[model samples]
Target: MTSTHATGEIQSRDRAPGELTLRAAWRWWLPPALVALLLALLCRDPFAGDWDALDYTVLALRGAPSSMLFGRTLFIYTNHYAYKLAHALFRVQPEHAYLLFKYMVICESPLAIIGMWAFARRLSGSRQTATIAALLLALSPFFVIYSGQAMTEIPSLVLLTFGLALHLRGMQERQTSFVLLSAALLGLSVNVRESVALYGLWLVVAPLVYRWKLDARTLGLTVAACALFFVCALGPFALIYLFDVDGYRAAWHGWVASMHMEEAAHPVTPYNFLPLAFFFFVAAPIVFIALPFAIYREWRTRGLSPLFALALIGLIANLSLITHYSAVINGRYQLTGLPGAIPLVADFLLRRAQARGRDLRRAFWRVVVIVSLTALIIGTPFMLFAWPTIQSHALTKEYRARLALLPDDAVIMAGGQTVAVTYYRGLGLGRWDVIGTGGGWPGARLPELIDAHLRAGRRVFVDADARLWFTDSWRGAETRQLVALQDRYHFRRSADALYEIRPRTDATAQDEPHLERLLAKPASKLRSLVRH
Candidate 1:
């Protein structure tokens, strides 16, 4: 009787916590989902808040160019078809389609929170710890901001965290199917955001670090499954490289040229440390505060758990890559690693609370509440008030309205707002050219191009204060050029940050043949003149 009871106890203890009843599952997940949904709806921005938001929007609304499909192909296509489906099924108006897309993006936040909860639950085996971790992520300003934007980051984050959860579950149970599916999800995530490649690196190194030699057959199966799934998921992109080599090359060159321009404009400095600084100080300061304690506890106990190791690896790899390569340190980049780190922080807090007794646990909960409320208080106002006031939103709205007022045949000589103006004018419209004074063109030549356009009987408009043209390296020269152009041409303020260049009454028209030749140049060639 005693032996049977002992065996029963052992089996019950070893059974996976994941096999929860439906009611129990709901209890575990519902709070985080509700909180995430509420926050996402409250913070949602009606406009594209980031520069790349409209780029992606345009690609989705219209099909992508061959060169554009070289990266983020899945994200682009998914949004494209999603919009089509919504329009077909619901008869959504074209004007309201972008708003629908934004709402679709917003829905990813709640899904991401649920993924985080599952990942933390699998990692820590404590419902309370997982809930805390989920809440932490839901409240993170970085997560909240990106969640509301129609961008790749939050969607990729959803894939990554869910994959991590499945990967952990598979590793613990020695399940080949789960491991392979996780590998496939991770591979798909890389298609959305290349930065997620580092998470795959951690998974590859994990088996060796954890010493899974005791389960040799399971380990072999895991390896083969991962290899097969990754190949299946990533093979399409490889086919693109092989089949359309020219397109791939064009995309690669475009990316490289943009990187060079950004580097020249921004200039690398000690400020490169900003990504790491933001991760530690701003994104989740409470997590960092708890991390040292977690590390010490793990070190003193079992030499650090594999869960903690995964968290550390993810955080280090992501921060290191962004710090080294990215021209600007965006706080949103840190969201890539929080799925791993938040769980560790939660586990540490819960364990410490359990060990120290009731009063200390109450104190810890109070701290968490304080931090959550603080982030909510600060983030809510910024998203509601300050975010809409960002230059991208204002500029895009102004350009859209101004473009409507301009003559259909008017030619726009654009600077920083080139993409915004181009997008608003509709892609088929061709009466526009990016100002290329800084891109190997002599400043004096700008007037000649303007004269050519004016001679062709086209009204020329300029966005003189476009921010992209005045990066640190080119600001001095660009400013001098702008000042000289303003002196020579009578500029009428057409709209915010936009000016109409009235041809001087004394100015003579340039050669008709020269004007015709200038106007005849392909739009692509004109666009290429700017660094892009």
Candidate 2:
């Protein structure tokens, strides 16, 4: 830690007669540098988890309906476009989209590292504080989790960091382009993931609230720029919605309706964000010390920064928890606030060291840098080793296990894992009728669908639990009868102890003539809000 002025304004550092040497300058970047290298080496495999949604979206882009427009489109379609663009130019394979997505994600780590360092440097006016902030971000488990995976979380976070960095600079510089670019980036971030829109609100309001004396022209410019970006960003989605109005409505309504189901829900806990700091001694050790100190210091001097950042993060997190009752509360959600929080954390810790009359500033910095590197060395294996495997089970199984048991032409009567199923479609498995929830087929419609498929000679595969099947009562009988119809069908386990059934006999072939004929024709794609 190095001392700096109490105000959150960057000040020029004047080194005394005996400053640290050339080799010591390495401390500024070595931590993230090493983490990047070690992560690349340890986890070379395309991240297997949660690749489906992004992958499917990429696939959609390859064959997006001409009717597709932006706002009406889902994340899946947007992701599809990103990949399609890359594939058209980069000549990459679809299965390998995760590879590209991973690189894009990992690439953001360095950007985040640089941005945090710059933001901190601007605020605290201490190179050391900037370095500390960057190091903390690099070693954080939460960011690293998404950085190496194919999910949109990291990309969204990266854009957010970029937007905030630009917005902060815009406030200071009052440059029109900077403000417009910031607004555009914020809009882009929201397009990538709706949750990020919360940060956009933070960007727009926090500044006006904190610095109420803005000139009328600057304020007008900022507001106009933001409005322009918002309209442009949302225009495509709006068009897509117009083209597929009913589909979007159905998807939205179905999602809301599923909220009442008891078996699949869980509660949100605020304490869930602990692991980001708890796991890595290198990165989180600093955050643990810095976060509280920053909050306290900001309360005394820079009140709005802490209040705004914390409020935004806490609000987004709690909202996510309440709506989903999910246990996904993690540090990634806090990425939006990192820029503001980092400087506060850095300044507070550095001030304390100065107040204590510590002459060990250089040594403390070296230790912080060294420890950050060490935490990455320690944490990389778990991320590379355990993370992919864990994610594979959670996110990749459906993507990788397409050939598990079913033939390519077998019509699956299930929901979820659409991308994985589509990926494995090449294995000769038939397209899924996708009964239940986001598949566009509700459980209530399942009995008719199942009978229709059976009458058409289409071998319908169902989950052993038949969780998605429509029944007046919850009973194992429906699935049991369905299974019995197949004199010889294959059963294989899927995640969470569910089994998939595939026909094994000609009787299965003979019993459902109508299904075969209907399924034999190209399946019709009805526009609907797809759950990714």
Candidate 3:
């Protein structure tokens, strides 16, 4: 009877001091969500970027683009449709659809933060580490900025984080339901953004690496789960096949062709580190600093690293792939795997803080203060108020002016970077025929396309801005085509960033005197960014 009583007592002792209950979870999650929502609301008047154009196009689409989505799959249409539902339900316009999307994105911020916290707590068994990880990632610049926009990255990160948290819980409790739910979430994340499929690597590697050997039954179960994940994430698209299998498959082939390895403009190199630097170091330096230590600790602690192995693998994969495949990589492309790495880093730092704080309370508090301040500064859109970079939110004025100058009826063939302005212009004018210079994909063959459009009695206006084509996307061909198009149509610069194709050669460029002062604002912002 005494032995039975002692066994029960031991079991009770093992019931974690702060298990993730509904109330406890809400406390950790609620504040960050509110703050994120508030900030997102303040960042109104839809910022100019590729996502803005893409969202606008999606809003206007009558149906899905077969198997081709954001050059991956048609899953992003889900968010677009969600916003469309909002537009219909709320009786808001296309512009306001973005606002609705941003607000919804903000809602996920808390889930991401609290999810990170819960996962960290589970992994490291430390509440302090969880808190720091959650807070740091919540206040990350990339996460905040993307969340404030109608973009896919934030949702992907949020879903991925929450999925990891769920997966950890499922394993800890040996519950099959939680594991299935976790798989579902991770699958949803990939459909939200294809790049996030990188994190899906963990699903395969985790079971194998965490336990050196597995029985046939377990292996079979793992394969079945993966099949379920694919079906959940992408099987719904099977409905598309119910309509036109040939068209969908062709479109799928086209998108796949673009990603062919040899066609890339650049080679991968040490420059791949940019994502790690831009996404993590710029926003949360402490996380970046603690990564090595975290790796060491996980390695030493009986391969405990598999808990966050997805994060590490995903980050590396993002950097490597983007560097090799993209014409010019943006920090946003690397975001999907970023939050995954933070919890590990946070735990490592928190453990050190605990070690040092054993009789040094004031020093410990000072360290906390510094870390908090750094995160806040990094997360804030200080560049909008202070930088000359394109990321600066103040440049919406320039985009707006460009949109205003373009004629409603003209078939605008503009540069790549000018997509945001062109898309918004087309949306406002109820025209969606705007095409990209260098023909977007056909390059020099754009001249023939232009000839055909002209033959069809369309007023084709060539507006290629060499300054706007910053990336190494089909370099020489685009430059030649730009010259050919300009020679064919007398293109004259109008306003600050707009161009007009005139019938005669005598047309002089119209000037916008206000552009100089407008440029100054962002220039100042860039200066501040550099100073920081």
Candidate with the larger TM-score of 1 and 2? 1
Q: Estimate each model's TM-score.
A: 0.80, 0.67, 0.75
Model 1 poorest 10 in a row by lDDT: 510-519
- lDDT tens per residue, model 2, 337-455: 45455555655655665455544365346547554665567656445544533444344344445435565556664433444555555323345444433324333445566567657
Model 2 C-alpha lDDT versus the unseen true structure: 0.50
lDDT of each: 0.64, 0.50, 0.55
Model 2 vs. true fold: TM: 0.67
What is the number of residue pairs that collide in model 2? Answer: 33
lDDT of 1: 0.64
Which one is best on TM-score?
Answer: 1
Model 2 worst lDDT run, 10 consecutive residues:
523-532
